[model samples]
Target: MIDIKMLIELFVFAGDYNWIGKERAIKMAESTIQYSNPVIPGFHPDPSVCRVGSDFYLVTSSFEYFPGVPIFHSRDLVHWKQIGHCLTRQSQLDLEGCRSSMGIYAPTIRFHNGRFYMITTNVKMFRNFYVWAENPEGPWSDPIWPDWPSVDPSLFFDEDGRVYITGTGGFFGDEPKGIYQAEIDLESGKLLSERRLIWQGTGGKSAEGPHLYRVNGKYFLMIAEGGTEYGHMATIARSDSPYGPFESNPDNPILTHRSTGSSIQATGHADLVQLEDGSWWAVFLGIRPVSVPFSGRHHHLGRETFLAPVTWTEDGWPVIGDGGKIAEKMDASTLPLAVDESAVSETDDFNSNRLQLEWNFLRNPQDEDWSLEERPGYLTLHGSALTLNDIGSPAFVGRRQQHFRCSVSTLMSFDPLHEGEEAGLTVYMNERFHYEIALTCGVEGRRQVIFRRRIGSLWKMELVEDFEGSDIILGLDAEPFQYSFFYSLPNGERKAFGSGECSLVSTEVAGGFTGVFFGLYATGNGKSAKTPASFDWFQYIKS
Candidate 1:
């Protein structure tokens, strides 16, 4: 509790670390960003960017996390604040049974005329849809389901006001082969043309995430290939007409790390944006791997959003980064390092009427099951019937475990009347893989703190200790491979538990497309609870 404010205090007083007074603490908080490359960090992958006026907006895929598709706004294109979510309403998306990496796929955001349009595929719903808002910050329209069912859908608006939706579709035997496009009646979400394959993408596997654009009167088609892993790549094609007969760039993949010994890998699924000064940029997804490569080099942080410079060749083909590679350090003149410190805060005060955009539920949550205003300050999560491992939506809300070496702690209070009722912190990967430390009813009507891990088919309580109180500050400090759990009383010393391997809840082990999430949960073990478990505050500090 000595420094519970966490790294946020660093940014708050970073400018004046030699603080003379408390008032200066508030004033100097807007210190310039001091982050390395991959401008936006942790699990924010499949980036699609667009610029309207001087402001640049980016959206990333949020698989299985309700409040799907996070919309980030950046003035300098380097620093970003999540303005809102494109799919905020239940009518907009339903991820009730979505497994990890199986909800929203790649989304492309565009601003045309007066409205901002965001289109993507809801894999769980098996539909490609788009939502529009006059203001990018939202009150966005509900899901507009286009008739076509495909992943990685992109919307293009032509100069003559015609519209098209391009995506990874059409099957070659069992595998979905090539990129497809179809003219669409934007107003009614009706297909105006038959869905047709446009480009197969330089003979790479899984040609997908097609974004159509017009540069200098020629239509440019950008796509992702090689299946979003170490072999991932960014490829392009160009055509004279809106719908093509497009020819692949001879220098096919415009960007990729591929066989390079570099740590950043899986570079593809990109979106392009042009600045007012005519500077070109590409926002794509990539990952920084740890030391070990096989079972050990797990990317617990998931695919992150990266910014790279794009230089168009004399013949009009684009070259990403310096030479078809993702640079670890981005140049200053290009992005300028200016960031709003609020975009990536280490702490959430939960002082607003609504939950912050950073908080996400396991699935489409029952609206009344959780609240911020219900308790004025603390987040009150009423216990739900589902458990953490259940396919049904649990009363669990969490944020992406953004860093491998970070500490997340929460102040929680819950009184369990039955033996199964519990509430505490959880490191959730998916329904089949997760770990939790909870305060629950134990033997002899005594309250106890417990540790439960559900990995693969095994589900068991690992440890239990009797507790005399309801309120406990639960903490977990994570490293790349290991994480230690701890609990502290309101006035007592912090108690540390045995450390666990980070791989237990990883993509390599859990077999999913998402990273880990540090979140708060309340559950009655498939039954309702008498009262709600309240989380006073949560802290996320990069270690």
Candidate 2:
């Protein structure tokens, strides 16, 4: 038997300085704090963070998912809590018919004049807009369309109360592609000056994600380059004025993992923030490849948010991470560790009236498709005509597969009345790449469990087993290399159904900007089913 109390004491002694003394706490604060990289894991990418006093708030891109631009709040930069989404209303984010990884792109969150502003591009709409809220956890205002026609728009408020909009300048055919800047009226969203090409990045393709900061009385213009792939990088240029002949830093490409054998790759699109203690830190995006045998690189978790310390050289240039490189684990001087207990829950019994912050729909979901109050303590999904193979919205609710090794289980009560109706679990990347373990009605209306996979144009029903009950537990175990699916009855022995290669739904094979989502779904192939599926509970636990 283990000494449980002794183990608890040892764990507290390791982290809680109050258990020791104030003197030791001071020494511990001075010492480096070791933390894991990709701080906000899973499909979260294109991170932008801002500090309001001791509290830090961050936002990330949400592509075609409804309620776009998920926002997070943190006390210490290491631990984060999802507060709410910026684009909650359909008027703010209309993702209808939007393709995967093509809706919202590269949102920048900033606090100015007692208001929090979030600016980004809706690539599908070919427009740049912003929203403002009095509180970070918001009832954010509707989109205020800016006159600028570009992507990755960032707002810079100068000391003279002048507002400047800096962004990529490639949407229009006549303008030369690079970083563009112009003065703007913050209230009216009107351009006050002509947009000017600031600095073409150091001969890197796709010089975008522009951010302008006034540091040390100098305007520092930083942008992401190299197309946000293996060659992605963050570069900086400085000048006395916001727009002009800016001098590129002697050490350009301030942060990147290109051409490196490190596990973290595609690092760029970073935002800088100065802590209350006067320390500088950067929040960026990077991807971790699965440690499996594959022809080329494969990452199923998508680009995730990462943190690194930023130190300035004597020459006033910024040094990021370690020599423009970062690792999975980072040791740095940081704020005291603070964990938010309400950040997320591993299990959901569908006890609440509304869905939790972790849950997201494929796109703009139809109100008639899903319900929590219909069958109290259960999530009821009325199967729609749309299937997973369609680009349109379907009856599905999913959360990001945050951990490489984890287990997801759901108790579903569904009896398909028609042959095409299916209700069960899925490991979904997009319409073209996904794997499913579903309960359906087979020939002569015999209840069965089927395992299906869709890789590009290939669709195959790999496994099938006879099942008796309408209520069954469907589960998926995710490993570094594969996902094993299983099923069981209530209080009954579990049975292994089938498995699928993890790389099949990876970004390398699927070729998308999004990652895999462990989801519960219901569909009728091409026609709406008369039956509905009800999930009693859903659980996700990391191993």
lDDT against the true structure, each candidate? 0.83, 0.90
Model 1 residue 335 lDDT score: 47
How does model 1 score by TM-score? 0.90
TM-scores for every predicted model = 0.90, 0.95
Candidate 2 regions exceeding 4 Å error are: 1-32, 340-343
Candidate maximizing lDDT: 2
Residue 8's lDDT within candidate 2 is 42
Residue 213 CA displacement from its true place in model 2, Å: 0.5
Window of ten residues with lowest summed lDDT in model 2: 1-10
